[model samples]
Target: MTSTATHLTLNRTGDKQPISGFGLWKVPKESAADTVVNVLKAGYRLLDNAADYGNEKEVGDGIVRAIKEGVVKREEIFVTSKLWNTNHAKEHVRPAFERTLKDLQCDYLDLYLIHFPISLKYVDPAVRYPPEWYYDGKGPNCTLENITIRETWEAMEELVDSGLVKNIGISNFNAALIQDLLKYARIKPAVLQIEHHPYLVQQDLIDYVQKNDIAVTGYSSFGAQSYIELGVDHAIKCPPLVQHDVITAISKKHNVTPAQVLLRWATQRNIAVIPKSNNPERLASNRDVFSFNLSADEIKSISALENGHRFNDPGFFFDIPIYA
Candidate 1:
């Protein structure tokens, strides 16, 4: 009578929060919603949408409908949204948050993250991709005054105090950048969401976050194979997880999809993953990962897939000099 994945376990965060869900990016902006709450009913407790994704109202609508239908309670969901680049100025943080809250139809969020370590100059939101002094058709300005990373981070801390956000996290930041934040942040960051997949696995970073008790969420677990459709040319055509000799052998041994194996690999290591698939069958299969665990040898074989390459390097963002 076990209805959930037996081996899957939720991790505790600030103030004793437990999360076992994945984030949703690329949710469609159109009318037909599959329901964010039904996703909850399917055991997804995390919805990771952002302003850049342009579907906050629909995401919020889905969640609300699910609640009204008696599918799940608001407290059971670990909702998250990020502050977009254009809003990096200290003065704009709250307004941006309020916009997100309004779109999400929620009073507070479980996690709010600084979308990137970089920043863009302030420009009117009315204009699409406002041309700024840094827009040499090149990249981010990263000027000390254009909106310092610390400035945005400090305000993020304020959100937690004001009870607008429960936990704080950072994405698109490297180890050095992460450590630098530790010097000034009063409320330590609780999670690090990164572009993780078998091919570009980051062990040292993962170990560092784990050593410090900061949770890690893996985005793009299937690798760049998924983003090629989005015009990212360098995205890897990941070795079919179900077909890779290592993954296939193990899946056969365990009677699970290569996906279950991939997820199980992360969950067993205390890493969190947010894999998305709108298809009901795929969603169910993706959620079916918690029943069993990978063997030590299976784990090592999967770990061996890493070769220190990053397919989603945000290099197109190279025109943005901040990371440079």
Candidate 2:
């Protein structure tokens, strides 16, 4: 399926990125590369990944296979990876980035992001790769790194200067935090990736970032599906968006599946979506979202589904409760 996917431009550089793509989170390492190759053949251009995801090497292999088989060129794919919490120390930043670059088999990334606002204590590379999520509470094996967001952002800015990453962005940031970041940022964040879906619309945040020219990308587009797998109590209790009557009705009206309705809802609002799938049917269905138009009434109906529900909060990791 060749795609005519919509794209959003970066704030300072004007780089246009596909509004929808295959998310590489939680993919099994053994099959990730093959899955990526298949997704590319099915028409996705954006490959959203992270170092914490622990599958960069497999993803890199898949990308290489696609190019080798004449499926797509490296320049045609927009690859994104994130710096993990443990790499928050300014000194650890470059080495951490270098590891990811080597794993992804790329000279530079299309976009690199601070995976979260909080920074954990850095563990020696000889000890462990991710160094566990130890920032919220002091553990015997890990301690607070005491690195501030400003220091981290400053280091990330230098990555741009070094041409290691073409664009830089933030993930999981709230409104006030973004405002604070913009105050001292040398280069405005090119994108804001967040957990966005009908259950957690975050419209105001989206509007604010887009107003400032930072494109927003949504993860967990299927509402509680991702969280449910993680055994999150709240997510397990919440109803799945795919089964919601409003979504199903809209899907029926459009002659598409409920999942497609959800993806279309995000894209229709100009927010990029990175929905992960290993199923061939879903891979094709997800990329084919741009073909149809959702009515203004339908879009509004889905927007009304927002309940301020967030499933990926990291407050549990810290003693100071980050999400107040």
Candidate 3:
């Protein structure tokens, strides 16, 4: 309950989060509960789900029908989810986080990541729930589980000591595995989630995890449009940050919408963006990206369209480079 002006204060549970949310990746578990009740009636109080996005029980039946039609208020919706890569075993991380908190009809979980510092082989959600990257799901081959990110960050610090997870993070991690997961993290990882846009601007791994207070979140902010909708020939030969010509000339000098100038160049650098859209007017213009403010030379000409490019690579579909 601390970070209000559009939120993002998390580091040991001063939880606030929603710096522009709503991304249940490739949303289409039969229209994911009416696209999570149309992005929570187009206001989106942070959703960002996973369990490898096989649609967590239709995004928890659209957050229980947008909280029985009051349209919000499951504690004002800040939910987030993850923990896949075959549940990175230390006794399969609390039964894959209680089967993603019983498929997201959550009793508690404001955030919970660890979705991929890669650790496969352990498929049995009754034989493949979201055991995605193949151990035997008929793949180009993948099965590598020696499990030790300090035994899955001490079982995600025992789901923040079993209050059923208020926070616990890491996703497609870097910065030397978050500096070797903060030298054996007991709980120090409130958020990191990457694959950020502007063609992979790792900005020194987002300035070394915001110089250690963590909280970063950026997912495919609209680069290669969700891996060119998964046909992924290097995301169909890259170059489509909403049709980049310096992001449509700074989205035509800020009238907005080169996907809101690549989500206001990563929320004008405070980072946090979720960016999904099943098009209810581009899902309220991708959560109205904090109503604009991108200067500093248009966020350095869109972070100078940095080309280190990365379209959610699992080493290009299971060759397992894990960012080499």
Candidate 4:
């Protein structure tokens, strides 16, 4: 599997980043090293990860193995990781970044992201690494840290200046938050990562980011397939994108899998996708998406599937309105 699409430029830094990448979320730590190696061998140039994933060590090991075997060089690949919510304090940011660097066994990351707009209570690094979300017990004992997005973004800019991360971006941020960030950001965010799929197109947000020259990366492109596994009722009720008849017909017309058709839909629109799979066949199929093209009609069909569905809302995890 391969892509004809090359790199997307950052609005602020003009850095070139690979358009398609591999998502490392929900990958079991035990199999993560091998899965990453498989992705690299399959010709994937970008590896998307985060401290919250808890598999950076295995991801690093896989990269090392691939390099040692002459499969790919260090600079040949793009690596991205995020700062977890627990490390949002002005002082805790660098320590968290250092640990990610140490775990990934890399000197510098191609891209680093603020994992979420909200911050959680900080935990001492001496006590735990990638500290749990709640500083106390679950349920009624939960609390949020007194930190601002401005403070976190400021710290992220420092990472770029320190040469620890080449570019900085934001994930799971809404339009209002991004507008506010643009007001005082010394280093503009280069990319915006969010949950996007046929069921949840987010056309307005995509337009806003692109208008600002920030690239968009869509996660959970299969829509309900991912969140349904978590027993999300809304996700469970919606038909899976891969199983939708419109997507199936398009796949049949193009002689590709439903997954490929879905990915091509995003890529054709100039949005990047980070689809994850442990199977070697699926991994290869994902990379092959760029081979086919989706017609304007086909694109419309997919877009029409949108019904304002959203999965993976932080509000579901917290009692308060985290997104608001």
lDDT of each: 0.71, 0.87, 0.83, 0.87
For candidate 4, lDDT tens digit of each residue in 1-324?
Answer: 123565777786777777778999989999998898899889899899999888889889998999999989989998999999888888989999999999899999989999888788887767766565767534454568789999999999999999989989999999999999999999999999999888889899999999999998889888887788888889889878898999999999999999999988888888888899988899999988667778888898899998988788877756646565
Q: Is candidate 2 or candidate 3 better by lDDT?
A: 2
Give each prediction's root-mean-square deviation over alpha carbons: 4.1, 3.0, 18.1, 2.3
Sort every candidate by TM-score, greatest first: 4, 2, 1, 3
**In terms of TM-score, how similar is model 2 to the real structure?**
0.95
Candidates ranked by lDDT, best first?
2, 4, 3, 1
Please list the residue runs of candidate 2 whose C-alpha ends up more than 4 Å from where it truly belongs after superposition: 1-5, 135-142, 317-320
User: For this target, which candidate reaches the highest TM-score against the unseen true structure?
Assistant: 4
lDDT (Cα) of model 3: 0.83
Candidate with better lDDT, 2 vs 4: 2
Models 1 onward score TM values of 0.87, 0.95, 0.32, 0.96
Model 3 CA RMSD to the hidden true structure, in angstroms = 18.1
Question: What are the clash counts of all predictions, listed in order?
Answer: 6, 3, 0, 0
TM value for model 3: 0.32
Collision count of model 4: 0
* Residue 78 error, candidate 2, Å: 0.3
Better of 1 and 4 by TM-score: 4
- Candidate 3 — which pairs collide? none
